[model samples]
Target: MKLKKLSAQCLLALGSLLALGAAQAQERVTAAIPGVVNAGTPIEFIQDGFKGTEGPIAAPDGAVLFTENNNARIIRIAPDNTTSVFLDNTNGANALAYSPEGELVAVQTIEPRVGVILPQGNARTLAVKVDDSLGFGRPNDLVVDKKGFVYFTDSGANGAVKPDPTKTAAPAVYRISPEYVIERIAKDITRPNGITLSPDEKTLYVANTAGEHIYAFDIDAKGKVGPRREFAHLEGLRQTENGPSSGADGLVVDAEGRLYVASNTGIQVFSAKGEPLGTIALPKQPQNLAFGGPGKKYLYVVGRGAVYRIPTLTAGYAGRAK
Candidate 1:
């Protein structure tokens, strides 16, 4: 995860900034008109004994895949409600996404590796800590576009004994193009964590966890990100008994262009214009979310050693059936 760099003024907005601090609500606002208050309901709890689960992505075939970072595995919850291990020995896999051809791309936080997991559970290094030319501190989260290009973050927190306190990589974001070209997209994020593409796949959102903000980028046809811009900032995120001791984790987009963020305060919904519209309360802090189920109207949340869901009024941006 990237660390937040803040001036005293920014801290006043977030309230308190900690890697795992609990959040206090400034105030509660009502959901906008035509929004469903009970659009979501709790679903099954897939308890696989994970110390923590960070990212959950919906597979094209309808299964929801997630990372068990503590256990070093990727688990899957089938549409039929069965649970299975998708891949083991993933070595600190934090976030995952599907490429255009359905290949699973994961950001490995351990040694800051990028891996492609085969459909059969075999994992191989797509990009490793090759040399000084690449940009990856400790890959934490990732998202893939309609093309095979992979955009991931590096946070560098696995069990490796190699210690580089002065690592200049400095919690940056990067993109691995279809041709395997690596490019440093941004460097100023204060602990960048979760990431997602827009419903139209024209924009990219990267959540800066410790900084209590999300950065938006314009995605060109070449899959390269333009200069970074601030999208939303949740100034003071804190932890609760439910999950995420503090900070933001993952993000998912809805069909209507609303962005849903999983953070210490549950799931916050924001309009395309960056207005805070409403929220889905969760028993635990949500690390990640995905829209699934029959009509793609269900939002699946992975948090606090469990997997839960609530229904939504709109369809999921990534799971529409043809």
Candidate 2:
């Protein structure tokens, strides 16, 4: 009788421990920004073992697409959570955006160019040289405006790779007009990694991975930006041997004009005017994110060779897929 009683006690303790573990896991998926995300919403791990994941964007059909840069391909995760290769031989593409004409525009880093990579056979280059002489300095991310203007960022030389004065251009943001004219828009950024526009397309936001602030630019009707301003101060910035790194990578705007940033802390939420709403912590540091799934109510995040998704109370901006 004593043996049976001790066994029952052990079983009860195990069940209690399991319940505690599950509750702790749910607590981690916090919905600090009330309407954006609800409390106790679980962040579901979809897949893992990616070579390198970045630049997640939503598809027109309610699927989420992201790049595995190290594998040189783009993967699509359907609403049902199944995965497939959307595009291959991406030339080391990192970030992706859909053009007004529904073409897949990407920032290719192998040859370091920005262009259309889809409708596959008809892929063409949009911009290659930063000037009449020098080439781009590692094109990082891009976003296509409504007028078909491709705005992208060149991250410049990183780590041991020193910039060659005669060849590589400095870090800057460039806009390729519909007429194929390459114009440098901003050059003062320390390290611009992710790029996005507001719901109205009147404001541009760029993430500085090496800095604590996400910069914003005022855009005119002619696509000319007034000046770069410190928009929102990011959380979870830490000093490293290389320098201060916030790990701010991807920017996406919601339908309500709220801005979401993928940073070292997790997904940082900000108001349309750059106010801190709160943060949604993840199992891994998110590198990029997008809203997809049915009704575009799912937030898909990719980083650290894994992909995760959580149901959001809000939908993504339907104006553009980012």
Candidate 3:
């Protein structure tokens, strides 16, 4: 009788362990955002152990290419989950976008410039210093319009580093014309991080890493942007040891004009009209994200030295490679 009692207790303990494991596995899957993400769809952990992963963009062949900035190399993840080095010695490139001319443009932070880095000899500087004297603080992210204009954000220096006002330009957004003319578009943002344009090219959106809201501007027909306005309030902002920050890092749009923002809370989805849809919480805080895979159905996210993807119900903006 004593042996049977001991056996029953062991079985009960084993069952409890199995149940806890199942619950934890379910927690890995994000909460569905209705039309955006389906319920019970797991946020698949693709790979990890990267150094400063950022600036993910889809290739023409459906592979996702991202910058391992600290490693100074671009890594490509194929559809079959194979990984390969796409480029090296990237000058600390953080964000990437494809020009209308099919060239890869990046915002390099090492030398702090925006330029093309691919096709070997075709590489050339697009914009370096904001002017002859004042250099950019730190070029963080960029996006190219159909007319070949590039819009990027300079996030400025972090708190640890003191920047001289005479040399380092304040945090701002800039536009590089097709003729390679650099224009300062907005300079009032506290810390401009990620940048993107609307699918129709009518609006420009920027994420403020230190602010509580995502900002937007109206784009004119001539590829100029107007006054800045608060588009959507971000979630998961808190008082960190460094100070208060929303942790809004990367921004992207879908085919239907919905905005997907990588924030401290997760991927916060907003409607075209700037209504809050729902947030998809991930296991790790996502610093950047872009749509990739067949038909741009997968949202590839990178942050904190890891990569993750989620099969989404809708697709990314088909007109652009971002």
Candidate 4:
């Protein structure tokens, strides 16, 4: 069943990518913002031609911290459009978000641990090993909420690994509570990648890179996830040989509760009610994104060797999270 669906989507993608390219050239406008936000806002290339960039998150200092996935370095993009390496020798780090204490919380993929970059430029391990019995393979992306609880995805979507039950790891979502307890919040999805909480922090949006769906789950007071429902599917997106083949990679939520998801169709914007609002098309397939810059009105997107900026009317859910 899954293969049949993927085959169909791939066929559609093969036929439509030419049209997609033509459309991108025409608009370069590329993004469709509906339901509330306007779509005419210009999307530009602030920085391009780097190593594989991913996991963009806003820092408290009006700059954006995005990971260079291929090089395992976290680069900071200042408001002035200058880029610098913030942290190096980072074990293939991916996603990053600021904690309540203003520390940079990051997911170090190869080490499979979460670390906090101190204000003085040091890294501290928050959570190591996923569990005693099962562990994380690739700690892909992460999001930190108000009370300092951490939610992240252990997505084994990068390479085709020959499965060894002794070393086999399942892709899932795990949470490190405020009290520093680690627990698996979800394991039903194929490879849980991008994650974000609503402004109210009651709903959690998770993108499955291996599968064609994005799932949303209700968050309890204690921070545990309730039952999940299909939030959205990769309607016009197709698969790739490596990953993100299902379309949804890194996703973010705005203060208006809109979800900005990265896929083969650029960034798909969904309203608070999970309605398909529109797509912010880009020249390259984006790996991750975040809302940063001075007013948090700037959308920073990272992809194969480049970073982009898209100005929007809505702000990010960073300082607005309850």
Best by TM-score: 3
In the range 85-157, model 2's lDDT, one tens digit per residue, is 9988998898999999999999987777898998888789998887766887678888998889898998886
**TM-score for each of the candidates:** 0.78, 0.89, 0.89, 0.84
**Tens digit of lDDT per residue, candidate 3, span 1-322?**
9999999999999999998885565357767787799777888877778989899999888899999998889999999877899999998899999998889999988778899998768999998888656887789999998889899999997522345667898999999989888889889998999899889989999999998889999988766579999999987888877567899999999999999999999999999888999998887789899999999999999998888889999999999998
Tell me the lDDT of candidate 1: 0.70
What is candidate 3's TM-score against the reference?
A: 0.89
Give a tens-digit lDDT track for model 4, residues 1-322: 9999999999999879987775565345644465434656666766776787888877767788888867878898999879999888777777787788877778876656787866646667878766765546778888888888899988763543223446646878888987778888888878788998888888888998767778999988876679889887675646467544566789888878888888877888888788888878787888888888867888888887878888788778756321
Q: What's the alpha carbon RMSD for model 3? A: 5.0
Which ten residues in a row are the worst by lDDT in model 1? 19-28
- Give RMSD (Å) of candidate 2 vs. truth: 4.7
Clashes of 1: 23
Sort the candidates on TM-score, descending order.
Answer: 3, 2, 4, 1
The lowest-lDDT stretch of 10 consecutive residues in candidate 3 is 157-166
RMSD of each: 12.9, 4.7, 5.0, 10.8
TM-score comparison, 2 vs 4, better candidate: 2
